[model samples]
Structures are given as structure tokens and as C-alpha cells.
Target: MIDTRWWQRGIFYQVYPRSFQDTDGDGIGDLDGIRRRLDYLAGLGVDAIWVSPIYPSPMADFGYDVADYCGIHPMFGDLEAFDRLVADVHARGLKLVLDFVPNHTSDQHLWFRESRASRDNPKRDWYIWRDPAPDGGPPNNWISNFGGPAWTLDAASGQYYYHAFLKEQPDLNWRNPEVRAAMHDVLRFWMARGVDGFRVDVIWHLMKDADFRDNPPNPGYRPEEGDIGRFLQTHSADQPEVHDIIAELRRVVDEFPDRVLIGEIYLPIDRLVAYYGEDLAGAHLPFNFQLIYASWNAESLAALIEEYEGSLPRGGWPNWVLGNHDRPRIASRVGHDRARAAAVLLLTLRGTPTMYYGDEIGMENVPISPEDVHDPWEKNEPGLGLGRDPERTPMQWDASPNAGFTAGRPWLPVAANFAHCNVAAMLDDPFSILALYRRLIALRRVHPALQTGSYRPVTAHGDVLAYQRELGGESLFVVLNLGGETQRGIALPDGVAEGHVLLSTRLDREEKVTSGFSLRAHEGLVIALSAAT
Candidate 1:
């Protein structure tokens, strides 16, 4: 055991700063806006807040493409504002985690500029630059994640630079010792500033295969059915050299006590566990994205939970994320009716839970008109329409103009009928999904079993999902209906549990209905284990 502390318990609020709050009237969010929302976050009872990248960038990849590792981006406010935000977050008993993008940098960044200045510059080898093929083509056929060639020809240097993502953001050559040292210095700079931790970006893609062989063709590449999931680029990337780099990053974290590193790795659970490092020196939590990939069915999820728990080595801590900026929000995945059940299950699960900014109120993805879309993904794919703008819509504070995001038009349109799903209205209505989330968090806090308990799956037929969490002296049973129809006679196995319905998002109006506890359609119930029985 790693001697768990304050960080091990409770939830984390992930704020996508650009869409979180815009303190300035420039139609963009900034650090000061985050400072203003501290009380709102503290009221939500999360131990810390994870801010997406606010570093200097050209906005090509929207802050993911960094120009300066240590400096704050002018659009997100200056360095002083970040310092103040850190101080304010700490003052309110909250930890602040900044996003670190060590995988790549904006081509406009000085480092890339220096590297491009000459083929023999001291920094030329810091980034991956390759020679053109015999036919004046890209070095390889590997595609950038955003589409097109991953390699871009630099006219000034007469060489091709590699970017796993966008051409504007060149990937760093971690194989170089200088590059690794510089990345560590970036960590040291932030640690010196009192920042609590970093959300390391693209940890799995840190190092590339040395031979640079071509990725095998995807025989199962079916765009209509998401068959790209099976195209393993075996000879292309995710090399073993990545572990050496992770150890170096872990060493930097070790120098600063209590500082944590969370990785954005997309590997399977078995491979993901290796990121925890042999001596617990790698990523503190290589994000478990199983929920995103699992079939939205009860039996499959139950099996996945069992597998997820079984895959962890003793002393390895697990973290669960339901939504992020890149994926569709949780409400959109399973639809609005089942959002509460998802919330109950997410909060009730026994690992760190991360909630997207507007997920608490059951905010669905907005409609992204092709003409108004800004995501490069949508731009590249054209008809695919898989961009993230809809999920990343401005937070709906109220039903007012622009959803109170700004007096000016928001960067993206707010969801239609915002009046019905606004946070302000939800706060006013006692039966709102927002209130249900607040209660769900409170229940998790009040019950030690819910926070750090051992999870056990209960067998049940149909779309009914059931599980139990047990701790030192208490246990709580969770019953959820993931489908539309009502499930009944959920006999609680041997019915040893005798406690009243602890909380329910749907049972509020029908408390006296029957069965002592009957789950309504798309509903959830958390009941304490009755002591006498």
C-alpha cells in the first residue's frame, strides 16, 4: 500500500478552461475565471481541480500545442494570474493540477524555430526530422492523428518533421538526452511554483519505434462501425524506450514530495498497469478509459469491472474517467434519460471519478453545424462529423443569452433549449439531475464503504445492474436500471439488507410506492446494509 492520503478519496472536477469561464470579455476563458469559481468547486466537495492546458500556444491544437512549457498563454491570462490562481486554490484547501504536453510543441515555438534555423543547430536533433523518400514523398505512410501525413517537409531545412497530431505541432524527440532533460526542467519549474501535479499528455505516444517501420494496413478499417479500434500499429509506435522516459519523468516527480503525475494513456488495462512503474515511480494513474470502450450493457460492464479490478496489481491505485474534451460526454453516450443512473454508478464506483464541467447537470452534446464547426477533426474528416465542438460547448450557467458564457457570442453555440437544462434551473428544482449529482457526492462522502470499499458484482438478469461496496464496518448495495423498462422484485439476493433507501434520483416522488424499494425506469437506488438482518 502506498499510504493513501487526502488525494485518494473523493472526486476531481476537470475544467476545460476555454469553455469553463471567460473572465475577460474576449470570448475566451482564463485563469481568473477559475479563481472566481473556486467556491463553486469547493461546494462540490472535490479534493482538487484539474485544469486543462493553459500554457503558451498558437491555438493550432487549442493549447495542446505548446509554445512555452512554463509560461502561461496570453489568451488564458499571464503568469501572474496563474500564480494567483494557484494561491487561491490552495487557500481554499484544494489542489490544482496543470496539464503538461511533453509529446509535442507548436512549430512556431522558439525551440522548433532554432531547430529549423540550420541542419546543424545544437537543437536540430531535439525534434524528429527525417529525409524525404527517393520519390520526394514523406518518409513514411504513417498518418497524423488529425489526418494526412504525419511528416511535414520543412523548406528551410530541407527535411521532414514528424507530428503525431497536427503539422503545426512537431513531436519532440525524447530519444535525445537534451530533450529529456529539458522536459524535466519544465517539471521542476512548475514544482518550484507550488503547482500540485501534472496531467501528462499522450504518455503512450512519448517514444516511437527506433526502426520507423510502416504500420500494417487495417484489414478491419470500417469507418461506419468504429473498426479502427483494432488497427494496432505494432511496428510504428509505443516503443519500449517510452518506459525509460517515464522513469525520468517519475524521478522529477519523486524530487518533489506529494506531487503527482496522471497519464493520458489509451492502452489496454494489462498494458496500462505497467505505467504504474515497477516501484510506483511511473504515472500515479494511467487513466482507465475502459468505461469509454465498454459496451453500454449491464452484463458487459459487470464483467469489465471484474476484469478491471482483477488486472490491478496489489498496491496499484485505479482511476476512472467518464468523459473528457476528446470524447462524447457521458450524457450523450447513453442518452439523457439514463444520465442519472450513469452518475450514480460513476460516483459509487471505488476509484477516483473525474466529471466533465457540465456533466453534473446532464448536459448533452450540442448540435455542431458543419458551417460553424472549428475542430480540425471535423475539417479533415468532412462528412464524419466526429469533432468535439458539440461536447465542448460553452457551460450553460443559466437560460440567459449565450448561456451566460459571455455578452459576446460564445466560441461555439450553446445547446438548443438551454432553458430546460440550465444549471440555475436545476439548482432551483429539487428533483433536478444536478441536485441528484450533489446528493450522490454527499452519499459517497458520508459512507466510507462507498469511498474505499471493495467492490463486488451481484448477479441479476436483464438490464438491471447491481453491485455492493464493503468497507471495515459498513456496506452499501447499489441497484441501477440502465434500460428504459422497469425491473422489479430485485430481491437483494438473500435480502439481508434491511436499511431504508439511502438515496435515489428517481424514488423521490414514489417513496411509498411498494416492494420496500422498487427501481423506477432508468433509475438508481443506493441502500445501506441493514445491521440487524
Candidate 2:
């Protein structure tokens, strides 16, 4: 058995705080609201909660833009409220991880305020600033993730400053030793105040090449919205310098025993593993995003799983996430009919799985009208279906009165379909998605094979996905029917024992029931085997 701490093996639920719950009825979710919902998470069987940023900000990029690293946003609560939240969550045996935005800071941050004061300000080197082009434009043609030129020319200082994201969130120049020390100190301050670790924000963007050369255009034709998707390469951004900084950050985390450090890396598999470092002196879990890419095909998923398992660093743990505040939720991605099977795939995987808020109830993306759209992405890429507001809507707790999330209006409107999809309604229905989630979590606890097992793929074809998870001297095989009708006689590897149906959610039975098994639409099973039996 793995004797690791709870942080190593426990399931984490990511909460987009602004949309989770609202206690004060000010159209915004707050820490107090999350405090009231602690029992619900405890019941859901999650070990920790990773709350999105709640620091003071102008709300340009929601809470991702931080005006103050140390102060709580008054909209969320005060220091006492935050303290109460920590105490309450710990009382529930749950750890809390705050979002750490080390890559950049809100343009209004005090350091930025002082740095932008004059050309020769003492803190001027804290942020990336450069002279304008000969034509007196931005430093280069490089674009922000949001849109337009990454460098914004500041008339006051007669220089162009860098921002990989929104202009309001300026990139910090990590080349300055003082800036690196300050970011590290910000992390230490949170650790002192009882934060478990950090979900390091935009970790790769913390460092950039000194030469402000223009990024080459894509060879393939594309709309100007997403990245240069012509090739899969992420050449300019994922620099090797990131490893040294991660080494330093890991040292800080080691100071506090059992503290967790998860990096939000959007790089490919090979590049992602480097965050763990050769000596394993890096982040605890580089967040896995394969589930997002392989949402449609079982064959692709099986191949990706094999590749990911083979790519892990020794002594390093694996983490899987199906959805987050940034991306569209899984239910929405895979369509409603396939989400249940996706749930089985998620819970039975051998790594720690993270459930995005509201996913348990199978929440669909709430479509946004142009008039009500708040995300800058949609604003920049209108009609491109690129806005994030759909997935960031308020949580649905009940059927009436703003879905029992807020007494007042919500920051983003809940889906009209919440009348059927909600906690109160699902709590009574055994077959509801929320109940299924609860059962899956409980089953994981009941069988150690589901948690600490080694995954081996079961060979199958055409809409039938099968795999075995083996550990603790036992193996549990799982199969899912992705098609609408029943599927029969799928195949497993050699040494297959006659299988007894452990659990099946299908409404159909196979005719032959050969070395493989049969499953109806969305039906999934966990069957175990032992050499002694």
C-alpha cells in the first residue's frame, strides 16, 4: 500500500469561487458561502479543494488579475472570514489550495503602481519594459492570449510593457532577482497563513526570451482566434528556464511537510514531465489535460494513457482533470449521452481525479447572449464559440429562486434547465448523475484496487472501451459501451479468468458472453479476478 499523506492520494475538487455559492446575496459567491457548503464536499468524499483566485482585483479577467497578493477581496470577505473558512474546512478534514498567480500581477498592484511612476523608478525593473519600434508601436508583433499586441505602449514612461494575457495583467520580469524573491515571498506568506500549497497560475509564462523577436506565423490557414495550431509545437513559450524556478519553488514547499504543489501546464506530454525535474525536485503534480484532448475516442484515450504512464518521472504522482474553470466542462464536451461513461473512466483511473464544480450534477454549458457575455475572449472572438462565460455560470443547488445559489441575482446566470438538473432533485433519484458520482467515489474507497492500482488496457474495438486496474494482488477490469445499442464479445488479454459481473449499469445482456463481455449504451462495469480463485 502507498503510505503517502492525504495530499498525495486524495481527490481534489476545483471550485471556481465566484460561481460556487453566495451567502450574502450580493450576486457573487463568497468564502462564507463555501463555508456553508463544507458538509456537501465532505459528503462528496473529496480530500481537498482548489479554489480559484479570490484576491482583490478589478475583475478584468474575473479574479485572475490580482490587485493585492496579501489582501482578501472585500467582495469575498475579510481576513477574519478567510480565517474562519480555513478553520471550517480543516474541521471537515479538507485541505485548501489557493490559486497563486506568480506569472503576472494586476496592473494596479502596488509594485506596478510604483514601477510605472517614472522611467527611473527604483522598482522599474520588476516588470518587462522595452523601447518601442522605429514606427513608435508596441515592442513587437507578439500577441496576447486574449488578442492584439502583447506589448502595450505606456505613454507615461515612453516604453512598451509586456502582458501575455490581458493588458490589465502585466507580465513580471523574472530576470530581476528582486522580482523572483518577491513572488517567492508571496507564496511563503500564504503558506504561513495556512494555505496547503498552490495551483501555480500560468507557470510557463513566468519567464520569456530576452530578445523580443516576432513569433512566426502559422503555415496553415487559420482564424486569428486560437494559437498557431498549424503545428503541435509550442516552441517559444515552454522555455527551459522554467525548470530552475520550479526547483526553487519546490524547496519552499519542502519547508512545509505534505504541502501540495500543482502546476497548470498546457504543454505536451514530454515537455510537461520536465516540471517534475530529473531529481524529482519540482512540482508535486503537473496537472494532466489529456482527458480534455481525448474526449471523443476510446482508442485515442487508451493510447494516450499508455503514453502518459510511460512518461512519468520516478517517485512522481499522476493527476487527472476532466474540466476546470477555463475549459468547457466534460459533460458539455462529450455530449450528454456519453458523460456517464466518462465518469466511470475518470473514477476508475489509477491516479487522483479532480471533479470540476457542478460536474457531479451533470451541468451543461449555459449559452451566453452577446449582450450578457462577460469574458474578454468572447468579446475579442465574437461568434467564435470561444467565450468562457458558458461554463462559469452560477452553481445549481435547488430548483427555485436562482437555483438556491444566491438570494440576489448571480454573477453569471444558471442554465434554464436547472429545473431538472440540480442537487435537491438529484439527491432523491438513485439513478441521477450526482448519485452516480457519490457511488463511484464510495466504491473507490471500498476497493483499494481502484485507487492505487496499475492500469493495463483490455484490447477491444469500435465503441467498446475496456481496461484492467491491478494492485494489492488483485485486478479489476472495466468495460464501457460508447454506442447506443448493446455490444458483445469484446476481448481481454491472455490469462483471462472467467469473469463474474461485479457491477453493470447496462440494461442489456450478451448472447455468447465469450472471453469478453457485453454492454448496453453508456453501461460500465468493474469486474475483479484473483489467481487463487
Candidate 3:
């Protein structure tokens, strides 16, 4: 095996900058605030942090709409603050990964402004613009992933610009050579500033169908699946040409030694693996989102893991994410009890795992009233159960007001249970979720089998999901009870007659086991098996 890269063996903590910590009393988290929290993150044992977008933006899509690719947002900080933050992050012996929004730019961006100035402008081709159909309507039946028509009429030019998301964020024409060159330079600008890597956003949407064909109607569509799911998105996303773009992007990143590229893709296991590129040249790790949307059950999750493992390209690394800025917190989805077990499951799996900012403390989604909702999707399509505000609440650092995330009022309200679930409350409690996460992270670091070993699923009836990770004569067995009630006498895999329980999600004392092992409801544990001579 190629020597394992730091990113491959390390745990990734994703910090949504807006909600991580606020230092300027502006009700928003900034670079300075993040710099102040480096000690806390290091204490948590995470190897690196993948920060969400902090670049200059109009906040149209909450910083996804980049108005300036090479500059920090005023709300976050200036170049000096960002440079200091990077230096501090490296000083802590942790890597920093910035969110790179490559598919589009804010309508207010200089390039977009020039593109929209006139039909004959030199940068007119920088964005996707087309003349209206004969009926004076949109060019096709394509709809934005956010809601409504994908094409927004530009009255000044008598044309319509297409957006995969909000109209304020127009999709860039990656087909244009100039646009590709400009975006590549954005990478170089940050690389020179000492960034460790980037998590490219919406990478699959970089190349839409050249003919602008209408997406097909979804046969599995349901009223509750949101407007974006009303169609299959076959033509508008996952076009084959997108691979070439990814290959070129990878080439640019390779110029910087020890730097990596991560792509955020929500495609199927087979298609998602393609982003790794032929010869493993695309994304170093295409964010695996199977656990994010999979059914919360043992059978389903086991099948999903097997499918993903079977689909990986030769020499391709794997990664897992349970929660992120765009999704509901894992504690909210699977209940606080099961989230502990999920944490063990996530970290023990044979791959790199990413933890959302507040998940280590068992943070759940806070309810957001209609007036408090800030997500563009919820505003555009009301009552679709699509608002992300609940999951984007400020980090609950302590019991203080606003969860100690800000000196002033936070951009989003802290969870009501913050007092009990805050980091301070869990810091010393051995049974707390935060403690469980730290233990799991530490175990992963010390155990080579848990880091780069091969995964072999063991047959376990009922709600028990069991697997073994073996490497260099070291074998670790992980078993999880995903059910709501106690499960007894779970048969250990044959030939694993005796072992020592190294750690348990409950943070209880280790025990020696033989043949059969019983598990409490929502319990998970790792047992170290004796190596065969």
C-alpha cells in the first residue's frame, strides 16, 4: 500500500464558520473567533478542519454565492486576519481545508457584472446565458435546485441566465476556457497563502448538458421530497464531461505537495466513485454521503457500506460524513441515544470520517420560527421541511447566553438544551457524547487496523451491525446495537472466541469476552482480537 496520507488516516471536523464562534460581537463567527478556538479543537483530537465558505459574498446563499474568490468576507475578516488564522491553525499541528465554490459566482461579482452588462461584453460567455425560447419564456423546462425556473430573465440583455440554485448565484460556464483559468488561479491564490486543501462545492454540476435538455420527471417523486426532487436531474447534473474538469483541477492541486482535494458530490455510489478519477487522479476523497440519507437501520447501513466499498476505484481512499451545514444534525435524525452509537460506527469504519462542528457534543437541531428562517431554499419554497437554519445554529460552547458562541446575539439561536449539552457540561463527563467521540478518535489514531485495514462484515441477526478491521496481524471487531431495545447473546464471528473490549460507546470499563456478547439498546463497542501467530 502507498504510505497513508495524513488526510486518509485523520479525522476531519467541519466547522461552519458562521456558527463556529463569534469574536467581533457582530453576531457572526469570524476568522479571529476560529483562531481563538484552536486549542479547543486540538483538545478534541481532530487532525484537520474543513471550514465552510468564508469568502466575500452578498450572503445570498449564506456565503456560497462568492462575490470574490480570493478575498475573505468582511463579515469574517480581511486577508491579514485570514493569514493569521492559517498560521495559527498550522501552529496547532492541524491542517486547514477551505470550502471552494467552483460551479458559480454571485450576481454581484465583477465577472458576472461584466457578463451581464451587455450581450457583446468580453466576459459575456463567463456565465451560462441564452436567448429566451420562441415563446419568450425560459430556454427549457429545467428548474433550479432551490426552487422555481432555473433561467432568470436578464432584461438588460433580453436573455436569461441559468442557475442551478438561486438566481442571485449564476452558474459559471465551465465550457469557457477563460473561466477555467480564472477559477484555477483562485486555487493558486490560497495555496500561496498556505492552505492545506479545499472541499470543492457542487463539483458534479460544473458541466451541465451542452444542449440544455430538460430534466426528466422523477417517477419516485413525492410531495414531501421538495421541488428539486420533482425531476431526475439526469441532464442538468452528472454529465460525463465533468470528469475532465475534475482531472484538470486535480492537476493544479498536485503542484502543491501534501495538499489534497475533496469533492462534495451526492451521486450514487458507482457514480460518486468516478470522481476519484482514472488512476486516482480526480478528488483525493469524494465526500461519501451514504450515511447522511440512508435509512437509520442495521441492514440498510450494512448494505450501503458494502456497496460503497465494492464500488471504490483501485487505490481510491474513502470518507464518511454523518452531518454537515446542509443537513440535519445526526442527533436530531437518529435521537440522542443512537447518535452515540453512530459516533462509534462512524469513527470505527475503515475510512476517514468527518464530524460536524457540534456533533461531538450531541448538538441537535434547534427549531427556527418562520421569521427566524434564513435559508434561501425555505424562503423560496415555504413549508417543504427544507430549512437548514435549525441545523446551522451556533456552537454550544458553554452554558452562557448564546451558548458562548458570541458576545452579542448569535445569527441563529442556540439550542434550548445548550445548558445541558454544551461543551463545558460534557468536558469532564466520561459518559458524555463528547467524551465518546474523543475516545473513538484517540482509538483510531493508535490502532492501525482501524485506520487503514480491510473491512469484513460479520453476520449478525436483528439490529446488530458487526464488522472486523484487520491490518498487519492486528484485528479489531466492532459491534453496534442499532435497535431501541436490548439485544442479547450476539454471536461473535467464528474463530474470534476470545477478545478484550477496548472501548465502548457507553464509556464503561473494558471487559473480556468469549463466543457470545450481549449489548444494551443503542450500545456499541470495539473489541481487540488476538493476532494469529
| Predicted structure with the largest TM-score when compared to the true one | 3
lDDT of model number 1 = 0.82
Q: Each candidate's lDDT (Cα)?
A: 0.82, 0.82, 0.91
Please list the residue runs of candidate 1 whose C-alpha ends up more than 4 Å from where it truly belongs after superposition: 1-3, 224-231, 493-497, 507-517, 531-533
User: 1-533, model 3: which lDDT tens digit per residue?
Assistant: 33799999898999999999999899999999999999999999999999999999999999999999999999999999999998999998999999999999999999999999999999999999988999999998888988889999999889999999999999999999999999999999999999999999999999999998888899999977678888988999899999999999999998999998999999999899999998998999999999999887888999999999999988888899999999999999999989998999899888899999999999899999888999999999888889899999999999888889998988888899888889999997888989998898889878888989999999545789999998877889999999989888876667666889999889995988877668899999899986433
Local lDDT at 7 for model 2? 63
Over 4 Å off, model 2? 224-236, 491-493, 505-516
lDDT of 1 by residue, 349-397 (tens): 8788888899998888888887888888777767766688888888888
Clashing residue pairs in candidate 1, if any? Answer: none
Measured against the true structure, the TM-scores of the candidates, in listed sequence, are 0.95, 0.95, 0.98
Displacement of the residue 501 alpha carbon in candidate 2, Å: 3.7
**Clashes per model (N, Cα, C within 3 A):** 0, 0, 0
Query: What lDDT is obtained when candidate 3 is compared to the true structure?
Result: 0.91
